[model samples]
Target: MEKKPNDVPKPNKENTISLEIAKDWTKRWRDMESTYNSHHDCRAFNIPLIDLQEVIKEQGVVSVRGYIGVEETVVEGDTVFIEKLIIVGVDANGKDMISSKDGLILDQESDDIYDFSDPCPNLCDPKSPLNG
Candidate 1:
């Protein structure tokens, strides 16, 4: 079947059955591996489940704390790092959102000159279109 863009597949009875079978097989494999490793002292390394959970929790806390306000912009030299560029309406809904361009301009005073006297063929001319 041809899938359209943004199409979501609906689950059926066959899919549910296959998913259950896969889960059962995975669990059995894990149990067998654990048993074999326990007696043989296998070199396979695995972090404890509790430790993994704690690490995940710490990561979530750090991510939440790292969030900056929408108006905040951190700049080092000529480089700018905008936290978030969003226009909010009076009702607290987002009107528009913009993202910063990425690239390190090594030399801003380079002698290279781009002639923009004619209208840009890419429709990205910064000058007023009505004037032209």
Candidate 2:
């Protein structure tokens, strides 16, 4: 799916962005690749997940502290964990490097939903999300 200009993720007040692939899109695109390079169409637009990550990293910073928020789910009363991840970065001296924090912006509006679980299970866990 095409990411709308406003759908871009952003950094928090402390300055940080999240890095995550659209799971469904990634899986589907990767799966199609496994079949017969069906992902060539996606390749045309250069919207691959890796490329997107690079853009995020270049534009903002990755948040070390994962955040959690409520998300609508396919199952009733089954809330999903909106994973807090990062994309932007800071220098060794701890300074904001990215000029545009827009890359770190997230769609946390009421209609914008996400999973509460950490997209990176190894990095950020439930505890962080819960407290976040």
Candidate 3:
């Protein structure tokens, strides 16, 4: 398996970004797209620490990785494409722990991929400074 999201050779507690940098990057995304932070764009997602711990508790999982993705959805009776963050378990070698069966390529619908994060704008902290 190859490291796709982080692109690192191995996992060792890296990939931490400062809050100010995160805020700026999020702000840039919000400013770059008109739909960002709006009904058409998915700004962020929230996952509980306890829930994330469950994924991390898997054997050989050393870190979690996230990938940007899009899904077909409808809002206000209109079809739309909203971005989402697809998180998954990463092994010590920095490879995604995607589940496979019978030696076949990983299926997109595999239950190992964690994509149930609560989307923002509808379920967000209105008072949080990170909402920008």
Candidate 4:
């Protein structure tokens, strides 16, 4: 007959107690912050900290272009994830002219070709820059 009992060591409560406490604390904190607060949207640096290459790849843009289309690219809710580098061209007037899988223009200050991490954080509205 094969031996069945006393082979495996029983888990000790001492090792797991702190881990359980930590988990419970984390859950309680999450619950405490669950209420709606205006400050949630004010987190300025909402960007993820990662390598530029990975960011670009995640955005599905091989290269950046100065323009999003014939008109200058404007920032909208749509173009939030594009990498800032890879813009290719710009029109005679100051406007981005290429379209990436991500969205409108990536960088704003730069008309020259270079890599950037963030897209146009602030863009003038193409429809009416003055009114909007």
Candidate 5:
């Protein structure tokens, strides 16, 4: 009746990052941030499958791409522009796929940009085998 990390789906071997490697990389990032006293509790982003599906439903969108960004927010009373992952739809040409209702370049500000994915350390899979 309770969920645990093992409840999370196992990584696909095709492009999987091993548990050891993931831990190492995360540790490196934390170490660097700790030196500056800017350590964050976040470790990953949770992009739901349904949200990703919605992005790819747009015309000409063949895939989604994630970019690292920074935005000012308070963490334990410290204002910081923490690194966040922003996901955007990508067209076949590898361009950010923005839609035009009139089939033209102009569109509303809410076009195809997506963010606000739930960050980890809170939403992460508990005790995941992959060290999530």
Candidate 6:
């Protein structure tokens, strides 16, 4: 006899724990981004952090993009975790400016690309003339 799909055991505990951790981290990350955006003179510019829960619910995958700083990665078991994503913001003159921690993270499975590279030189520098 074949078991029904609903008979399969669901990893509820694991999923719940992962969701909680993701929520906590997302809040902290957004707070940090808000502070950085405020001081960088990009009041009009916005880089909304993508909601992983929503993405997972809608697309069954965690994919997001925005101005985040730095790109650090770590491998745990078979999964690779990327962090410190920096989003680009506009300068006082409404020109795009890249964060000092700009980098890229490409998800092969999802075909999602997170690009934070500074197209203009020294945009993250405080003393850079382009900052104006």
Model 4 lDDT on a 0 to 1 scale: 0.29
* Number of the candidate with higher lDDT, 4 or 5: 5
lDDT of 2 by residue, 55-90 (tens): 334433433122222222333555332323222334
lDDT against the true structure, per candidate, is 0.24, 0.32, 0.53, 0.29, 0.52, 0.33
Model 6 TM-score relative to the real fold: 0.23
Q: Which candidate has the top score in lDDT?
A: 3
Q: After superposition, how far is residue 104 of candidate 4 from its true place, in Å?
A: 50
Between prediction 3 and prediction 6, the one with superior TM-score is 3
Q: Which ranges in model 6 have alpha carbons more than 4 Å from their true place?
A: 1-29, 38-108, 119-121, 124-131
lDDT of 6: 0.33
In angstroms, what RMSD does candidate 4 have relative to the true structure?
22.3
Question: Could you give candidate 6's per-residue lDDT for residues 19-110 as a string of tens digits?
Answer: 22233334555666646544443322222334233223433333333443322233453422223333223334554332222222222332
* Alpha-carbon RMSD of each model: 28.4, 16.4, 12.5, 22.3, 13.9, 16.9
Provide TM-scores for the models: 0.16, 0.25, 0.56, 0.15, 0.54, 0.23
Model 1 — which ten-residue stretch has the worst lDDT? 63-72
lDDT (10s digit) by residue, model 5, range 33-123: 5553344566777777776776667677788887544444455766544444556678789886554555432255433555544667567
Q: Which 10 consecutive positions of candidate 6 have the poorest summed lDDT? A: 13-22
| Predicted model with the maximum TM-score | 3
Query: Candidate 4, which segments miss by more than 4 Å at Cα?
Result: 1-17, 36-132
